[model samples]
Target: MGSEAKGLALSAVDPRAAAAGLTPGLPLAEARGQVPGLVSLQADPAGDRAALTRLASWCGRYSPWTAPDGEHDQEGAAGAMIDASGCAHLFGGEAAMLADLVARLERLGFTARAAMAETPGAAWAVARFATTAATPWRIVPPGALRRALAPLPPAALRIGAAEAETLHRLGLRSIGELETIPTAALAARLGRGVARRLDQALGRLEDPIDPLRHRTPLEVRRGFGEPIGRREDLAAAIESLAAALCRRLEESGEGARRLMLVLHRVDGTLQEVTLGTSRATRDPAHLKRLFAERLDGLDPGFGVEIMTLAARAAESLTARQTGFMRERDRTVDLSGLPELVDRLESRLGAGMVTRPRACESYLPERAVAAAPPFVTAYPAAFAKGPPRPLRLLDRPQPIEATALLPDYPPVQYRWRRLLHRVSKADGPERIAPEWWREIAAGATARDYFRIESEEGRRSWLFRAQGRWYLHGAFA
Candidate 1:
């Protein structure tokens, strides 16, 4: 790697040796010896990836469908791909988005190149190889990919190293040279991924994006000027925006399921906070209260000048059209759901906190799991079964024991350290395994046991394959 890697060990003279001339896969010692003035230090991949993820998250303001492209971040590489198909216009059009993206990256002290195209391949090539100033971050103009990628070597298409070496040997260095070659030969040598990438970049094939952001009903946002210097000023601005957005919802008889507030500082940094409600709601007071909980965290280091409020996962707002006579008179309180989700999500990460979900497996361990994170938008479920356990272990632990009634609780048990004596015991609740999903299809049956020890400690235990383990304690 080069001195541009920030901490990669270099010759202590020139900081751009690797970025300037040395190639990847070359020994750093050799690279340093060759480039006399190289200055470098060791690079941290973890830090680079984390920094890129943060930048990618910040880029979510422009397009929620953005995702980090690669896992490795040794040096000279770190970026995200934004799926801008349906999101470009939301940012005041593509040209504005490009300018904003560039300006934001510059403020963050990053060298960035943004490109817009009909396909990811085209956008990737343009962003990686084209002249730094392409317009419209989401819309790909005709022939733009061709003009943008022609000068770069065929390796820009991300073809394998061997194929690049072959191209170099055959005097076909630029992408234009490889493009002129017959497709059959390239396909025979490089396999399908290469030809596909080339065709996709040239816009000759249909390449649909699997967006990072799933399709939701709507998550609309509105921004305001006049820096909100005080909490009251920011709150007032938010209430006004919420009221305006609620008007749009009221017209369609709909309401927001979740609301997000984004405060963009004058220094190009962004602070975003989200609130979820139990039921669909448009109450400005409730919304103000929710945002107020996390308001202090939104520090405006350079003074926030732009405030954006977005309403997400909209639901039909039920209203008493005629208090005494209306079909929608009995409205389901959806606001409560978001309120709980917001509170729990605030303490734990959106992924860590989730609702119990009924899983479709007979194995007790596989019968339940957490719902997808931050998604309060699942449709109703109709699966019904016996009451599930209030307490379940993430994984079952093995125990040594001896049973008395063959189908009763363990008379003596041993696990981890000490042995236990079961003075009282309950019958076994027979449970079966999901043999169909078994890797080798030889799983045994399980029997649940609820036991009370002489010490008055009650435990809900289970036995499988001649083993007894305490799964949960009745407190």
Candidate 2:
């Protein structure tokens, strides 16, 4: 249930509730009046989002480019968007694919409605508003989007609530009626959003789907006349596929970070092997070596007839000039580091290798974070300021200190049951909290001090809100 202008209201309802004259957005009291024993539970938006994400991931079996569509106007109904541009033939055809998708969803106890068209906008409209009880799915042929979408309501255009209400008041109930009005006149009447959405639905504008998982466009495949099950043959095929893929990446000035090898067995079963690199690269030999470490124990069910290699993730890479001198320069060459990391991760596992990266934060603890080795972007440069301690405490330790002045370094301090007299002191560098962060109430600036005790032990101390704390130690 969710709060409405009137009171607690139903955010969703099953078909039975709808048959009893109950609908989403209906007040809970009124819904109970309609059905005496209506059962309800509080809404979990986060859980719903997570469920939708999982559903989108599950749909990846159909197409790699899939994402959860939770912004549809259909009451209590969520959807997923799939870009099946080149994937239809794998499942026989578009019609067969759609039928199979719906059948699988129904078997999973979900009341599903699916549609296919030239554009996502039209498909979304037809799936939710155009399907009938006899047929819960529809496929609008190419160039038939306008004809199919004409009979749908204006709400199917994905306009705002106020816009739909305004369209209703203007006597423009159906999409056909709205299309009759000129573009300029419609924009003057309802704004550009309506016109843009209309154009998107009619395929005049481009609407691309941002996939849940990024899949690289560079790919190469090999089909054998006779199925080969030998490990040596498979290894050779991987080398050839890797070479072809690398050629394509070099042509596009890109490099792959992640690669997926799909082995299609003659028995209709598929075996997949995935590998990730520490940095983007287009070296076919390197890619082959990386895959060699992961191809062991792969089951070649009846026989593998088709092998497709796809670069699942990629990044832009350009050639760099090397020094003209034959002798090695004094500057350190970290180019081999990425290759080392790739081999280690390939043997160990993805995400098992990491490195520290600087972050954009003023807080000492938040200034650095762990990140994947050899990330594409360069690390942020540290600000030139006072030197930070070599080692920082996990959490600042409280200490009793006495200072001659309110804003000066401590003359003496007691920490961990030990007392020390300050022999030398450096600063009271004041650092203010980041303004953009959501700081707690009464949060104040910190005054840091670098001091050496009589025993020659150097420490970093900070004072906040009149309380002194030992934050770090110098080596």
On residues 192-237, what C-alpha lDDT tens digit does candidate 2 reach at each position?
Answer: 9999999999999998887887865776777687898898999999
TM-score, prediction 2: 0.60
lDDT of model 1 at residue 396?
A: 70
Please tell me which predicted candidate would have the highest lDDT against the true structure.
2
The reply for model 1, stretches above 4 Å from the true place, is 1-15, 71-75, 86-93, 132-140, 206-212, 215-217, 224-227, 247-254, 316-475
TM-score of 1: 0.60
TM-scores, in order shown? 0.60, 0.60
